[model samples]
Target: MEYFKKILRFAKPYRVYALLNILSNIFYALFATLAMISLFPMLAVLFKQTEPVFEKPIWNGISMGKEYLMEYLNYFVTQKSESGSPGDTLFFMVAIVITAFFLKNLFGYLAMYFITFLRNGVLKDLRNELYVKTVELPISYYSEKRKGDTIARITSDVLEIQHSFLSILELVVREPLTILFTIIAMLSISAKLTLFVFLFLPISGFLISLIGKSLKRKSDKVQKEQGYFLSILEETLGGLRVIKAFNAESRFSNTFKKSTKRFYNFSNSLLNRQNLASPTSEFFGIAAIGVILWYGGQMVLVEKTLKPELFITYMGLAYQILTPAKAISKASYGVKKGNAAAERVLEILETENPIAEIPNPIEKNTFESGIALEDISFKYGEEYVLKNFNLNVPKGGTVALVGQSGSGKSTIANLVTRFYDVNEGTIKIDDVDIKNLKKESLRGLMGLVTQDSILFNDSVKNNIGLGKKDATLEEIIEAAKIANAHDFITALPEGYDTNIGDSGNKLSGGQKQRLSIARAVLKNPPIMILDEATSALDTESERLVQDALEKMMRNRTSIVIAHRLSTIQNADTIVVLQKGEIIEQGSHTELISKKGAYQKLVEMQSMG
Candidate 1:
């Protein structure tokens, strides 16, 4: 219920709809009880049991409230029978009963009608917030998490919360109120019989609660298995090329099958338990009715203390409690199931992003002097990827970072972009600490083109203009020309308006990289970081992409992290890193003259 309360907070915005639902439910419950009670007067009229009365009954106080209501109804029946025939009295009684039932169904529909808006409204807001938080979180947050689990939270888990939340409102306001009104009517008919009914109800309620106790644990397994299989499915799609290339299709298929089989078992157990709720509750309801029949029989037939029509009406009211009781029991299990999903959904929504902005952050829009990495130490976990590292990149100059795979070339680009903050030191952009700068304003100063040319399934024009929202077609084409991507784009079907399929798979490696470069160029930021932007292409593709990079790098403060030494030979300064430390720094020619680590690397590459 702690989690239930937290999930309900999302429904706060839909209070008006919630209020309307509750208000409609109140009327529905009242009418539902009255519908059963209306049968009492009709039964009296049917059996010709009402004694004629000439005058109306007097109003009485609370202690005799039940007797007063009975007398008043009898007086009204007596007057109707006196003025007209017995058949006429019966017709009016049947009409009153019909009207009561009609109002009951009408308000019931209205309750659900208003609740629909509240339920769907909460779902929309929760999904929107989860997506926003997912995007705002640091890249490091995803490193240890599966994309599919997050996807499950945003999609299925939130859906669970929406359903569970609605069930809660029903349990709290509708079903319980219906049961309450029904019980009150039963008490009015026979207080002693009502007291007898309570004895069996508590026992049935306790047994129902016991059955639902393990439901949350089973539901957790079901939701977790769903996330697991979804992860496998997501991975299979993403790495289909690799799976096929390695001839491991059967392995992935078997893995997915195993997850689905688990899901099958978990769902069976969960739904079977949920299925038990209805029958179990109904059985207990019938059992209580049996007990009521035994006890109330003595009052009606043997004791000569109760009226036949009132006893029948009391039984009708007694049966009315069963429906809402069964509903509450069923929804209690749903709450358990929903609570499991709520925990998963709230876990993501309530996560604190480590890369949060400061209260008084400096909104730096311009990059003038340089980027400084002073005494910086950073790590993804325990072992530092960069330790006490330092560098200075001047304005309008090209600086290349070259290292082996684990030596931290890409780490430099990540730090400079503020994707991950340094552990022990301050990274200053134009002499202002990045920690003090607003994240949006800091990232706005730079453009990044990574090894993976990430592009959405969008048009070529939209992809190029992604960074600059208001960029005109002329600006887009001009940027594409500078990145050497204009000719191929013009040759594509529909030209700039052509749809690039998922991750831009419709284009070649070189074409994709050039589009990414064109995207950076369109942004026209002061600082450009190219982290192995041409590393994954064929020889021809690499050459075409490198030419685009060279053109775009002009008059920009550039940080080029590359492995192909030939590309960075003309860099204004070449910084060579190994094991998270810089062992050499100079122009390529000077590094060649050092006869050190950089020289040895160049010699080996030449041999290759």
Candidate 2:
């Protein structure tokens, strides 16, 4: 219930719809009760239980409102039957019932029409917020979470909340108000019998509550198993190539089958308990009706304390309670299920972002002097990848970092881009701490190109122009020519408008890498961080892209993490690293002359 209220806050924006729904429901409930009560006079005339009043009844005060209305109805029926035909009176009574029912259904439809907007509106807002949060979360958060689980929350779980919680919300006013008005009608006809019906109702309510006690727990299990299987599906689709290469399709299939089996069992248990709501409430309602028939029968037939027509009408009103009672019971089950889903959705929405910025943070838009990494230490776990690491890059100077795998070369690039802030120590740019600057402004001054050329399934022009919004066609072509991609792009089926397919799979490795370079070149930021951009390319492709990279880095402040020793020979400064510590730092010529680690790496690469 607490979680349910939290989700209701999303309804604030759609309060007007909610207000209209409530108003319509109020009229619907009134007509629903009146629809049944309107048939009382017809039943009285048909049963011949009461003598028709030929004289008009005097106006009665509010104290005798029920009695006054009864007398007026008898006098009206008497006037209709004065033509010596009771058929006319019965027809009039049926028309009154039909009119009451017509108004009841009309307002009922209006209520549903208005609630639709509120329900879907909240769904849209909730989904939009979840997507924003998913993107805003740090990359490290996904390292421990499943992409499919997040998708389930956004897609299936949110829909469950809409169907369960929002549907129950619709019933909250209409069903209970129906029962309230029906009970009022019953009590007015016979207060003694109405009070007698209460004895079994509490017992029925208690039994219904027992069925829903464990519903939330079981519902949570079902939703979780669903997320688990969805995660497997997402993983299987993402790694289909590797799965087929290893011939492990059977293994994945068996794993998915096992998850689905558990889901099947959990869902069955949940639905069986949920299905009991309707029959259980209905059975209890009939039992109450049976008890009323026995007691009210003796009062009307044997004791003669109750009027036959009034007792018959009271029975009809009591039956009306059954429908809303069944609805209320079903809604209680929905509440439990919705509460479980609410917790899952709120888990994502209520999460606190660890990467937070200060109020009124400084906005540093340009890099002037240099970037300084002083006394920095970082660790993904207990063992530090970088401990007390220090380095500096002067403005417009190209610095190359050479190291083996797991030697913290890429870590430097990640820190410089603030993808992951250092665990300790400070990174300063132009004498101002990078953390002090607005992240957007700091990133605005830098461009990054990674080993894998990340491209979307869009036009060649759009992919390159992603770096600069609304860039001119001539400007896009100019950037492509600088990156050595212009010739290949112009040869494509649609030239710059060619669709790249998924991750640019339609293009060759060299062409994709060149397009990535073109994107970075378009941005033209003051600082460039190239993290093994050509390590995955063939010699020919590397040569072409390397030429483009060198031309682009001529005047930029570049921090190049290189895997191939041949690529960084002309860098202004080359730093060789081992185990997160620099073992050598000098020009490529000077490092080769030193006959140390750098010379050994160059020899090893040359032999390969």
Question: Which candidate comes out best when scored by lDDT?
Answer: 2
Per-residue CA lDDT of model 1 for 1-608, tens digit only, reads: 89988878878998998899899999999999999999988998787677766577777788788877777777888787668887888899899999999999999999888888888988898898889999998899988888888898888888887776576785678888888999888877788889988988788899989889999999999889888888999999888899999999999999999999999999999999899999999999999899888899999899977889988888888888899988888889989989899999888888998888889898888889998999999998889999999999999989999888999889888888888888898899889999899988888999999999999999999999999999999999999999999999999989999999999999998999999999999999999999998888988888888888888888999999987887887799999999899999999879888889998888878933
Off by over 4 Å in 1: none
For candidate 2, give the lDDT. 0.91
* 563: Cα error in model 1, Å: 1.7
Best by TM-score: 1
Query: Global lDDT for candidate 1?
Result: 0.89
List where candidate 2 sits over 4 angstroms from the true fold: 83-85
- In model 1, the worst 10-residue window by lDDT is 48-57
Residue 308, candidate 1: Cα error in Å is 2.2
Can you give the lDDT of residue 204 in candidate 2? 93
Tell me the deviation in Å of residue 601 in model 2. Answer: 1.8
Residue 100 accuracy (lDDT) in model 1: 98
